[model samples]
Target: METDFQTVEQAKSNIQALLKGIVGTRTVAIRDALDQVLAADVLSPIHVPAHDNSAMDGYAFNGAAINPAGMTQLALVGTAYAGRKYEGTVKSGECIRIMTGAVMPEGCDTVVVQENVTVQGDQIHFAPGAVKAGDNRRLKGEDLTQGKPALRAGRILRPADLGLLASLGIPEIQVMRKLRVAFFSTGDELRSLGQVLDEGCVYDSNRYTLYGMLTRLRFVDLIDMGVVHDSPESLEAAMNNAADQADVIITSGGVSVGEADFTKDVMQKLGSVNFWKIAMRPGRPMAFGHITNPNTGNAAFLFGLPGNPVAVMVTFYAFVRDALFKLAGANPTAVPLVKAQLASNVRKRPGRTEFQRVRLERQGSTTVAHLTGAQGSGILRSMSESDGIMVLAHDLGDLQAGSEVEVLPFEGLI
Candidate 1:
């Protein structure tokens, strides 16, 4: 009997449960940390700014008590700008007109609003004592204290995070290296790009689509192993080499029960094959396994995706890539997903969940998605033309027009 699987969630959970965090590590510059998960906690090395500074383009006073007579005048001392500090101490009854980001001068407690004073040549009048020391002033390490936890482990690095790290003078950071993924397509019916098509031969869309999708997601590096013939030894040799070279292996087709399908047999012999038939259309025959590196005792995980172009693309986004990232020591969860409105009319038969490729149109505060005219798994047009996929529930047999459904946007991920 074969492994009994029924739902996409079940299959995904089963597959993810088998992955352990990869221990490999590498150092990446702060400029290159975007999208990479931090391996260690980032602590603030010093107080941010390292000194006191002004927040507004106002004046700095000796934090003096305001004296409101008919007119009280404080002498205009000097100007302070960012990166340049005023070294002179403010005298009593005197204020310094400052600019934004200017450093606070010694003996200055509060910044009186420039608008509140009347300037007469080098002298200005304060309305009264109305402020305190360090008002609107940014003290050293105010934004981040010394040794505060600025970033924690397992957090994916983003633009803002990188900026903060740079402000802290961190030039380089330690991150889990990107998981090396080896990709191949298995089918005699497929032909490579830039090659003329022969009778009964179709262009190998899966290999390229998978490659593009992986590239868009910012994978560390992808090895294009290309396509392999259906010979058992040829398939085995390809798998063995990839397992030795890459941390994760992904192949489309050859996992199904057909005369030419030898992927499962080789995967099992090379490692451990955990079989399952997911309860979803277009991606029902996905498989997962791990081939132990005989020399190093480390196992290279393999994800067997469907041969259909749309199926391969959707399943890779939903499944294999997450596991690959996990093997590279990235945060296994929190992958991006989007929701769109159902624009076109599409209906599905009961008993299986359907991932329909749909073109999303933004029309007046709503996103409408239309199913690609052709829905055939082998038809690569829908996958190429559509923006993303609209998911139909497993038990939903028919979805009518104008019915609201959830759609995951392609975003930057192809």
Candidate 2:
């Protein structure tokens, strides 16, 4: 295992290079495929707006009958409603009243809105320059053409995607199988909830936080393995058990350079693992590799995170979230960062990226980030009280008040 320090970007790139989406796909109805990854490209089977129809409630007439500079008049033959078509051909000096989405009558390619025409018994009068040729007619295949790709493979189906599929008359689609993820926390000083609070032992908060984070990703089947004691035998048994059932395994703590942290030894013995000291604050010590179950030959991707509460969340968002999406056959998108001005000056070192918790407030038209209390890796409440985590880049130092910064909001991320 390599213990050299790596930049955050380098770490991310390395992790991405070593992983691929899990295999296997199954057909599912569109109704049950929300947030699921598409296994194949969805092609349009038929043209949208199958027939030429009216775009507005108006009179449909041939474009040749339109008077460019003077008043044009035509006899109103009949009225057409949506989902119905005027059967008879529209001859010269004749038109038909058509509602929105109604199929245009034969030889009628334009529509003069009802508000733009005057009714005089059976004759409809159009004012000068009222409408142009094909002004309000919807052509067939205008929205989507048949035999064309509607949604590509590796797309995460959303509500809008479902509607688009329904519009194409698709009842079912193929989607990648749900990714299985098993996670747990490791530390002798950590205690489960409802247990006696002994001296020098604190309640484990990382598992709960990990649960919340993993649950947000609807495509993942979460397996919470609870807390494991920091022993080589315990760590190996847990890793073997998790790898047999899950595609990915996550552990917080026991990967750091401490005597009590036996995770590094256990992981290296089981498989080829890399221990990394990433160049980022709140989360620095991390391990990435695959743990194999020797008996079953089943291996799972592993993420060994730091022990701190805030560090677990930060590292998971920065690294694990996208990796999970990728392994689940999804085209993962990075969380967007918005520009905001700082409320006060902050001190920082020059080579490490820092994620500082801050509350956002609107100052006139500008958004300002107010620093939260004591930005520490162990302070979990710092994340709770803040609206976002301002990312101070690696090269920045001693930012002055009112300086601009990039912030990842907690609204969608947390």
Candidate 3:
């Protein structure tokens, strides 16, 4: 099959088209639910502040043209602490003592900050020319109006979102469930963890890398479907077992056109398969498909990542991870990428996309990114020690120092 590898923008569009509203909808609690995309529009059931209040500890007075600078004597009403509102009206030349978050009295229009006013036995002294109208008042529903959209669909809730929801007294929210994912590795040269390595057997680093990456995504279930050797029957059995329970299956290695590889043949027999060699160095031979579990008649998407540590990581981040978000009912939203100054030079191939691991450091109030030395595909240490991928354009072969480049934080879209 002729597989014209999709460009980044084209790939994003394709993923969007394939996964529009794929998660459907579900509900969850607000506690510890940050980054879970909102499934529905959040309508403000009530006003945000619920009432007009003081934003700072201050003195509330009418200030109805009574010069506060020259005013010497004023009656001191009872103090209004936070969560307590003084219900009485403020007459001329009279002020109410109000604390931060306290509701402002009905007749008061201006607030004199506590620093600008002095209290002496039922009398308050205001500094010269200090009366400011609406200085410290938090207007009712200033943040949001009744029936207003507090939050929109497809938004990944953050700390502020949680705080706003809590302020609205919404203890729970509707969110799509996490993506259920299953992954495995196939190779005769691979060995599981804690097992003594025999000659020619390398520890399967791809499995752990995929596991960690999936863990960072906070998926509903990151199931390890176990190791499958270079056998068609074993590969088929693993696929059938995983597809029955998992929404998506992720396999590392063995998608290339090799005689020992059984992933492609099994994918064809079980379900439709689409294989492609991405135009990216260290991650070129990545593949994607769908698989049908024979026993349960359930089908799920399958991803075959390259064997190299760097290739698998980059491909997982770009391709497989996006697919998992779609399966989890997320908005298929693109993760944010920021531009930062480059501290050192970076060189790459002109035709292939490169994701260089970099460490962003603060140097004299400016953040600069420097490439980690080892660029080999087998180096897992680089990915662990660095911040995130510094994506280089396909046509650009070299990035000079002091040039601004995209910096993807490790914490993004987690």
Instruction: Provide the TM-score for each candidate, comma-separated.
Output: 0.86, 0.96, 0.89
Q: Going through the candidates in order, what is the number of backbone clashes in each?
A: 6, 0, 1
How many clashing residue pairs, candidate 3? 1
For all candidates in order, the CA lDDT equals: 0.77, 0.89, 0.78
lDDT of 3 by residue, 187-260 (tens): 88888988889999999888888888888775457888767888889888899999988788888888766646
Q: Rank the models by lDDT, top first.
A: 2, 3, 1
Encode model 1's per-residue lDDT on 103-208: one tens digit a residue: 7888776676667667889997756454445577877787899888989887778899999998989999988777788899988888898888999998888888
lDDT of 2: 0.89
> Which pairs, if any, clash in model 2?
none
Worst 10 residues of 3 by lDDT: 15-24
C-alpha lDDT of residue 136 in model 2: 94
Per-residue accuracy of model 2 over 1-414 as CA lDDT, tens digit each = 133667778889999999988999999999999988999998999998888999999999998988877889999888888976567778988999899999987789999999999999999998878899989999999988999899999998999999999999899999999999999988788899999989999999999999998888878899999889878888889999999999999999877777464567789888989988988998988999988989889999999999999999889988999899899999966778978998999998878888899999999999999999899999999998988889998888899989999998877662
Higher lDDT: candidate 1 or 2? 2
Name the 10 consecutive residues with the lowest summed lDDT in model 1: 63-72
Best to worst by TM-score, what's the order? 2, 3, 1
CA deviation > 4 Å runs, candidate 1 = 1-3, 62-75, 91-93, 106-118, 122-135, 194-196, 259-261, 293-298, 332-336, 349-351, 395-397, 412-414
